[model samples]
Target: MSESTPSTGASSPLHVAVGILTQGGKVFITRRFPDSHQGGKWEFPGGKIEPGEDTLSALKRELREELGIEVQDARAYMQVRHAYQDRDVLLDVWRISRYQGTPHGREGQEAKWFACVELPQLEFPEADQPILRRLWLPPLYLISDSRRFGKDGFLAPLERALKAGARLVQLREPHMPLDEFEEYARLIAGLCHRHGAHLLLNAEPESVSRCNADGVHLNGKRLTQYSSRPLDDHFWVAASCHSAEELRQAERLGADFAVLSPVAPTSSHPGAATLGWEAFSRLCATANLPVYALGGMRVQDLARAHQAGAQGLAMVSQIWGANSIERAVTALASS
Candidate 1:
């Protein structure tokens, strides 16, 4: 069940701790009681942190009480704030990296383990959508510099990068002819599929199906025009956002993730107004979707970007060139 809008009241957000316990590649989830709050919804198991208890302590207690498992290891993943009409919630989500026993719902909820890829098909609290996005996003997002690499120049290095573990890539070629772009997209799709990477066209929705591309990356203008997700659920949709409101719009429109731009000065738009790390952090704080800090970013900035609340960094210029692709690949392992 989804949260209901409130009539009126002073909203006090509830701070709850949720555990994402994993085994192999699957995470554990539990179903809410059919008659309870958010009834019948599937959720990561956890409960409210009691007064005088810290997050970890509360989490351990909750798991022991609700799932009969002792938390062996866990780390904070992401923090989210969402508002239902009647209430606001602060979800302190954790990735339970390790645990001791088999999980069973002692509270009478049905428990199951699901691979992250299978998570989207389940019904969850609206608040968990952001968590899902975070899980789906990779730590490094790459954008093609086809303009600079020009005709046959970018392909080899791109394949090298993919072979070296580039998982998420965007083929952004505004200068290329439409026919050439589509042909290239087909080749790129084959390469990406071979490397088990996701390929997104920085083009129209129609272009995705034509080339077997995974999805479309909406330019800021296209992002604004869409009232809802432009493609169906199977396609992974992303957008480039420049402001907090744009990020909000991306979330509202069900974007899988977003690239928030001009986080630092870039050659892409010389002398453009930059959102310094402080401002960038502030913008990302309000975001419910995974956001990558774009503009003048490189492999070295991955840690700094993550520290600033970004899922990762998205790069173009820094990712292309003679030895830069190798550096970008090395950064992935480090990030």
Candidate 2:
């Protein structure tokens, strides 16, 4: 959840809210009835805080009243003060852990749980999209070689992962039929856009245009050819860099981000020599642009990379065909 730390000065009325993020990362939300205020809308559970009530106390009361659930742990994630047509509201979003009772609608309303990607399909209030973006972010990134997981393909699985909280994705679909690949690319782009996620396509500028994805991912050859002028404003340009020289070259070309791979060797690439964590840390610390650990990676490696100055992790295959997208997303995000 992001706080409304406005970059500029603006004053608005103060209203507060809290969201109960349940186990496996499913968020508890309530749906509004038609003809009510912002009626027929779904939003995080919690209501306005009184003049004297503390954030936690107000959240507990709101949960108990709205959903009939007892909140155990309620801590603030951020404070968002926004102005509405009628009044100002200061929203304090909190992740609720344990509750005493099952959540049921009190005022002829309904409550349900959903993974991040699936949330957009629901009738949530427009104001809640920012929180959904935070829910889509993962801690680590796994730079992948296409079809590493036996040719069922990456799109379906990655969609599941993205639902689970994967904020960033890289489309390095090599060796696949370009015509067929465009279909997959379009599917992934739609998913990312719905969930507020980032996507980078490896060079294949044609794919970026046809699929209308987030941006381009440049390989060693493409990185060297860039001259600072980008083809599109919507597409972010990232490069693959293996050394300091390569990193500098990528930065000079205005690459949005760079993937520094071989951070570790794994079953995916048995013949490749891996760069141990120390060297990976050194390379990341010295780089000017944001860096992601590319080689064989897991959800757990995000903390290690973060400490070493990396932005986040990327992955393929880990997110596909999963039954519990929420669990997988929480694992990646918390890890």
lDDT of each: 0.82, 0.68
Tens-digit per-residue lDDT, 48-151, candidate 2: 77778888898888878888888887656545444446545666778786778888777658777777668767765545544554454456553434464533
For candidate 1, write residues 262-323 as lDDT tens digits.
98888768988998999999998888778898988867788888899888888778777537
lDDT of 2 at 225: 78
Per-model TM-score on C-alpha atoms: 0.71, 0.54
Model 2 global lDDT (CA atoms, 0 to 1): 0.68
Q: Over 4 Å off in model 2, which ranges?
A: 1-138, 142-155, 317-326
Worst 10 residues of 2 by lDDT: 1-10
Q: Which candidate is the best by TM-score?
A: 1
Candidate 1 whole-model C-alpha lDDT, 0 to 1: 0.82
CA lDDT, candidate 1, residue 17: 88
Q: Choose the strongest candidate by lDDT.
A: 1
* Model 2: per-residue Cα lDDT at residue 143: 40
Cα distance off (Å), candidate 2, residue 67: 40
Q: Residue 177 of candidate 2: its Cα lDDT? A: 82
